[model samples]
Target: MAQRIRVGIVFGGASSEHDVSCMTAGGVSRAIDAQRFEVIGIGITPSGRWVQVAADELRDLRKQGGTLPRLSESRPTAVLLPGQAGGARVATIEGDRLTDVHDFDVAFALLHGPFGEDGTVQGLFEMLGLRYVGSGVAASANGMDKDLMKRHLAASGLPGCRFVTVTARQWSQQREQSLARIAGLGFPVFVKPARGGSSVGITKVDRVDDLEPAVLLAQKFDPKLVIEEGVANAREVEFAVLGGRGGPPRVSLPGEIVMRQAGAFYDFEAKYVSDDDAALLVPTQMDEELRQRSADVAARTFEAMGAEGLARVDLFVTADGRVLVNEINTMPGFTHISMFPSLWAVSGVGYTELISDLIDQALERPVGLR
Candidate 1:
């Protein structure tokens, strides 16, 4: 008989995308193969506190609204310390006295945004010599910052929209100049927190008159900002990038997101709340050449950023058939209806298979400064 692998599915974080991360963790924990591995659930509150939360508790908190998800413990909480410490890596709680339950061979981070997805946590894993799923430091950092991501995409010879990076300092001191600079990007701009996800602090400003307020709105989410030249009446197409240790980046069939809302684009509400409202067309309605081109851009974006495990590459396809890379998420959404998982599912990889493959990638990669 073989021993089971301890897998800690880390979720929830200090980021604004905390709830979404919890949901992702729940879905991942539920789908893991019980017979093959031992699963542990860990949650970090929006206040940046880490604790071990049960799978049921995470789901329960979601059903009951307004309550900030609670953490069970803080002291000696579950930390996937390097297997060097011996015993089970998952710090288990048998009513207070921490017990090593199973040696966590790998971690599947269902975390998103800021601290979790932005390479901060990934850096910690690197220091501890622990293997974890998804992109590493460079890839995670690039994926988190919109402006940096755009530069990498263009330098890789991939098509991308026009935009300018505005630091918090510049926006604070040179307000008018920053706005004027963005005006050169044309009207109908997208103001987004350079390192945010789940549409937390994104605003689509149609006219230059409404640009300043858009900057202020995005400033609330992140200090750095990226204002993009919106593609007028363009189709939102996305592709999934899956890569492991030696696997070449594989792109899934493109998917298109149709914004049915009254606003200029898919905002916070249009993303999670109105999933049924927006039309998510799979195998995006692109000519064979354009479709292949979109996929090529996605693959290039993934490789350019040195993304590993997986990424969801989003692009804006114009009415005249030009595809522009929008952004990349190292730890993209994994919900059943989320495009990352949906595209993979339609491409012949089931949710369970997708989950397993990510873990396989983590375990295969040797954890270290490498």
Candidate 2:
């Protein structure tokens, strides 16, 4: 029998999206192929401690009653050390004695948001010469910052929504000027933390009066804030891209998000808490030409950012048929209900197969510069 690959599933990060990462990890722990891969759950506590999480503990963390689960620091502290044969080993430290856990053949990072998704952990993997899923350091960092991401997208000659960014220092020094720049983007704009995700610090301001407060709210998450002009009468659509080891990436069918409740965008609650807030339309009922165009743009966006393993590119399809790229999530949400997996599921790739494909791709990829 072939050796079962030891795959370390890292989750429960030190980001505002910690709970979400735990949720993603729970889904992955349940979905990964048990016959081919030996799964190890590494949970990072909110205070930034790495600990070992049991498989059943992860499985029991299912989303219930709209409450998200988080990793606690009470678990045994886990450490990753360089192995003798150009690899890494995970061990658990209990009291003063240390027990060797498992050496990872590859890592499947289920972390999201800063510290995890923003290339920090990727850099650690690279330093340890351990191959991990998702984009490399540069790509992860670039994809996490909305401002830098939009700049890269526009430089690549892609069509993206008009946006303006304001730093905390700039806002403090010249509040009026900052507001003026944002005003140019017009009303009904979205104020978001430039380096945040899961719609945690996103606020949609329909009028100029509420813009500053929204910006403040976003700044609470990060020092930099991005204000983007809302696409008029636009429908939110997403396309998933998966690849890394060989030819061009594969683009999944576009999915549409229908906001069910009035005055509710795809906010945090709408995305994970309240299922009735929105419904997904897979392979959206869009014109064939438009759907293909969106798919092509999403693939191009993924390549432009130098993303690997997988990514989800969001787009805004206006009523007039204009498809504008909204943003690209390098390490997007990966829960079963998340749009990334849902899009691929509809595109014929089951959840388990999708996880397997990502691990295979990561194993095939080299750790250093490509």
The number of the candidate with the highest TM-score is 2
- Which tens-of-lDDT digit does each residue in 223-319 have in candidate 2? 9988999777689999989984688889998888999865578898987678688898886887889888888899899999999999999998888
lDDT of each: 0.78, 0.87
Output the lDDT of residue 267, model 2: 93
Name the lDDT value of residue 308 in candidate 2. 96
Instruction: Give one digit per residue, the lDDT tens place, for model 1 in 255-292.
Output: 98887754447767777676565788876667999888
Which ranges of candidate 1 are over 4 A from the true structure? 54-80, 85-88, 92-102, 261-263, 275-277
lDDT of 1: 0.78
Distance (Å) between predicted and true CA of 120, model 2?
Answer: 0.9
Q: lDDT score of model 2? A: 0.87
- TM-score of model 2 relative to the true fold? 0.94
Flag clash pairs in model 1.
Answer: 88-102, 88-103, 89-103
